[model samples]
Target chain A: MSDLKKLGVEVLSMSVDSIYTHKIWQEEELSKMVEGGFPFPMLSDAGGKVGQVYGVYDEDAGVENRGRFIIDPDGVIQAIEILTPSVGRNDAELFRQVQAFQLVRASKGKEATPAAWQPGEPTLKPGPDLVGKVWQVWKPK
Target chain B: MGEEELDLGCARPTGGPVGVQPDQVPPEREGKSIEEVRKPMVSVGKKAPDFEAPAFYEGKFKKIKLSDYLGKWVVLYFYIRDFTFV
Candidate 1:
């Protein structure tokens, strides 16, 4: 999160735990991170109200699922990925996704990214020169 | 793997190409596209939910509301537990 802040990305993390447990955990885990310099806000959802609204609440497991939603500056959800309880999300992939979104937004609908694509790669425009032009510029090793 | 009777909603034999018969199509997939396989947990374009709850700021209890940050972009995330490794 601190690294992302340095890159000019604001992050807010929320939790669906009680205030007492939240406080204890913050003292045990987050205090060390803060001492080591972590710049971000952590919100508390004591009663699972926020989690219920987000639809990530799991009553059986008594916790929110691992979900990642990338909202644009206009508050529109551009991309979302929800993982099962047993799986964890990848931070490097998230960075790439952010880069991809930034590139697409910067292009202003002139270009579109292909599957499994990354930033600075060749983008294809939907026109007569679509596949042919893309293939010409795309050098897959 | 038995020859007694095989009813898999297919007309072809056991070793034939696997293809769905006209009547074998599940009712759920009758008129849906691949994009409609799963619905989003939350509506993307709708207004965000508002909440008035106790939040900690600067080591003190503070009241925060979703409406307070209406004009700006807010990323509201939810984790199962506060201190668990995510």
Candidate 2:
């Protein structure tokens, strides 16, 4: 959460549960799991209206499946991921994507991050000369 | 020419054109299968759908709108339910 905040990103979590349920769950379960409870807002997506738009709502189960969206400052979605209840999200991967997107946006699409790119790693400059030469600059172990 | 020798040129992959406006209801919503309706309305290059919902924040219940955070990056996530492992 702190890392996201450092990048000037705001996180909002949502589910079909009511606010009352959120209160109890936070006080009892989440607080113990994370110090001071969750740092972001917990939205009560009653009736799954919001979930329906995001395409995570499960009508038969009356619940929303796990989904995540990364929206840029322009209110455009940069990425989307949907997962089932049996799986958990990888926070590190999510953070890495956020960083990559930020770099791309800052560079105005001039730079493209390679796979498993870290902050200081070299980024690709898309051009005709670099087409087949990517192998020379970036060697995947 | 062999498959590797054939130059297709560098062209962006094209997706089906969006026939329905974001805010408008599709004319043939009923004809769409469950999978189609469940497809995410927003895409990477498209604007995210704006919404307002009740939220619990800092011990207070308040209404929050997606537009409120327009000037900052947002990481919106949905979980199956509360009190479950994330």
Best model per lDDT: 2
Residues A42-81, model 1: lDDT tens digits: 5556545455556676768777777666665555666666
Q: Pairs clashing in candidate 2?
A: none
Model 1's alpha-carbon lDDT is 0.56
- Which window of ten consecutive residues has the lowest lDDT sum in model 2 chain A? A44-53
* Model 1 agreement with the true structure over B1-86: per-residue lDDT tens digits: 01122232333211211122345556877786432322233566565545554444444444455545533444455566665665
> How does model 2 fare in lDDT?
0.79
Worst 10 residues of 1 chain B by lDDT: B11-20
DockQ of each: 0.14, 0.33
Q: After best superposition, candidate 1 residue A134: deviation in angstroms?
A: 2.8
* CAPRI grade, predicted model 2: acceptable
Give per-model TM-scores.
0.66, 0.83
What lDDT tens digits, residue by residue, belong to model 2 across residues A36-103?
A: 98888778787776787788888999899989999999989999999989899998999999999999
Off by over 4 Å in 1: A33-38, A139-141, B1-53, B63-75
